[model samples]
Target: MDERVDDDITFRRLEILLAFMETGNLARAAERLGTSAVTVHRALHALETGTRCALFRNEGRNLHPTEAAQALAEVAREVLRTMAEGIRATREVAGYSADRIRIGSLYSLTSRTVPAVVTGMKIRKPELQTELVLGSNADLLQKLRDGGIDAALMAVPDAASDVESEPLFVDDIFFAAPVGSRYADLAEVDLAACANERFVSLSEGFVTYGGFLESFRVAGFSPDVVMKTDDIFSLMNLVGGGVGFTLLPGRVRGVMPQQVQLIALQPKYLMRQTIALNFLRSRERDPNLLALLAVCRMARAGLS
Candidate 1:
């Protein structure tokens, strides 16, 4: 037998060989490779032909690797690991290294939600570095899509194909008002009831602001927003100072001063914003992404 080694054998053949060795059956190997059994068999045959050796032989329904296969399997594992490490190193050079997971979230979540989550993530993966960026959902989503951030905790935008979302929590929007205000006396005030009240609200780029607008639209009225700001803290400050009332999440209430009172919306058009962990679907399988996701899942469980 003339043994010839071809560099042109291709990574696909090596991958198929590895899959077959790991799975120990043609059908299962094909499934792992996302191909048909015939395709996997052909690739295996091509690998054997290129190497001038039998990699596997049928033992009843199971395919058992010959000595050559076992030897090649070790080489294949090392090659795959080296390839992965090379790719990771290259990504690091290009600044995509997963040494630090960049996280973006709304200002409201920064007070409690994000901090709690990060504390948990730190406990779980002490070596994993984290960078937390605070911004509105719209701003954070844009950052996430642009690769400025690896993931975000924010309200899900309208259907987007590029991003994957994992729901972390749902926060209810509350009607916040100054204490002893006319509306403050009511246990729950309807959207229509606040139609004439001066409002302090988030600017156009916020998810909560969108919900605020939607709630008013549903109630056959538009909010008379006297002031608009980018930060939830600013909005809360304004409300606390009696500049105007606003619709904010209950979580925001936790950080606000005592003067601001949160009341339930009547006929309760309860606007619940779902906070989700968002990441690019294209990078889902990257090892760094896997680690980040594991940390996030741990954080979510701890917070819950």
Candidate 2:
């Protein structure tokens, strides 16, 4: 037998084989496939010849498929399914490659939402490549304005005429403190309660830093900020090491150490952070941008 899996094994032949396997007769298979019985027979015969194996046996006037035919039918279904998926992906990308959906995000989301969005986008386009850029909300916005990134997932800032942004989810600001401290015992912490507590925070430029300052402003007393660092992990580590309590988004819980406890802010002081997907109006229809937007919505929707 001259076995081969080249172009000789055509999709048309596989379809006929599957139909015959289902109906168990040439005429019936032809009717199911909207083709003539002779055409179906010829396709099956060609398939058997290409595979160099006998896929059917004649018993009286009836043709019964052999085990090989049944096995080939299963393989054909899988191949066709994969082919359909590839065609759909190609259509989504308009057959483009070497293009990346550059995604800029905040440090907080880098631990959770960023990864989920990237994974979701890949699932939608297996060949799609993504670049995850992490920075402060201001830095991301600058990159978006300068065309450094295709899109961004970050806290929504004031609207600009050229940038298109949509709110995806609202994450509540919380008071982050050491796990066993007195602040950790409270179900929710009021800004006034932590007024005298030493505060550790990310330096200026971070969206969370603004949130932290706002919470203090609303309480009518300024926190005695003991440390101000440019990185969130360092700030979190300081908080966890009993350096001070800090204000952070709820998503930060996924990144910081177990010794750090995040408590909700009291209703009066609770700040709602609007997470949004930002893009330039000009690139709204770009296929890669579209796919990334879809994933951002899905990931945020799941969180909501």
Candidate 3:
């Protein structure tokens, strides 16, 4: 892309482009943009002229944006959001608002680990503004790489290059089944015993699911899987509803209902996951990240 062409693109033009794509009619687009229809049309014309593309076609006095228009609008949304965040961060550092930090974590940790970490950070730095983002293991790690989040609290085996990680704590995996299931009567359940049972597990992209499969692999058997969900709660609900048994981390103890029973796996298949806090190595010196690290360390040490 030519720098001159890039320089010619403006937020106003992008806004008009997005508005037009969203509303599809010049009058409606102008209403949303708080500008005259003529002005909106002029902005659209300038955008197309600068980009040297025909962004739309006339369909009975209404402009129908081409496929290119939709694609550019999508890219424009990301660019505008990134710029807005950049400006917000600069303003925050300039003392217009409290210090902001973005922390990402796995959805399963939302019930326990994240609350503990965020509470500690607020108690220590009262003015620190924190955003807690929750997603699957892969999503959180990608956010860390994209600079969307400052740190990620997730399981090990992340294996993302250029990222620095520190172990926060260890949570053992347990076999979850419906209350009063045959396995619940036993203190410990062997993987071989469940070889005939159906399992409900999370889908791929989650480290917990990986560990669950690895445990079965180590036990030399593959249990029948009835369902695979994306949410940990959904997995638990399936188990509680007697859909099938699942494997979950010990941290879910607080949220698991009495209808769900967690049986300790046999020693040979006992899987423990190390939840770690990871950030870009380049962001090692960021004070907010350091503060989050410190809070996590203190919390982990206290639990120990």
Using TM-score as the measure, which candidate wins? 1
Q: In model 3, where is the ten-residue run with the lowest total lDDT?
A: 91-100
Off by over 4 Å in 2: 1-98
lDDT of 3 by residue, 1-304 (tens): 6656555579879988888888878999999989999999999888888888988898888888898888889999999999999988875653233377888899888887888999999998889888988888888888877777888999865456788888888889998989888887888888876788888899898989889999999988987998999899888999999898889998898899879988898888999888988888876877777888888888887543
Error of 2 at 122 (Å): 1.2
lDDT of each: 0.81, 0.83, 0.85
lDDT of 2 by residue, 1-304 (tens): 8955766689888888888888888899999999999999889888888888998999998888898988899999999889988877874454223356678988787777777888898899888778888899889889988767778888887757787887778888888888888876788787886657888888888888888888888999988988898778888899889988888888777788988988888888888888888888876777777777777777876766
Query: Candidate 1 lDDT, tens digit per residue, 104-195?
Result: 88888887678876776677667779888888887888888887888888888778899988877778888888888887788788787566
* Poorly placed runs, candidate 1 (over 4 Å): 1-86, 93-97, 298-304
TM-scores, all models, native as reference:
0.72, 0.66, 0.67
TM-score of 3: 0.67
Residues forming the 10-long window of minimal summed lDDT in candidate 1: 91-100
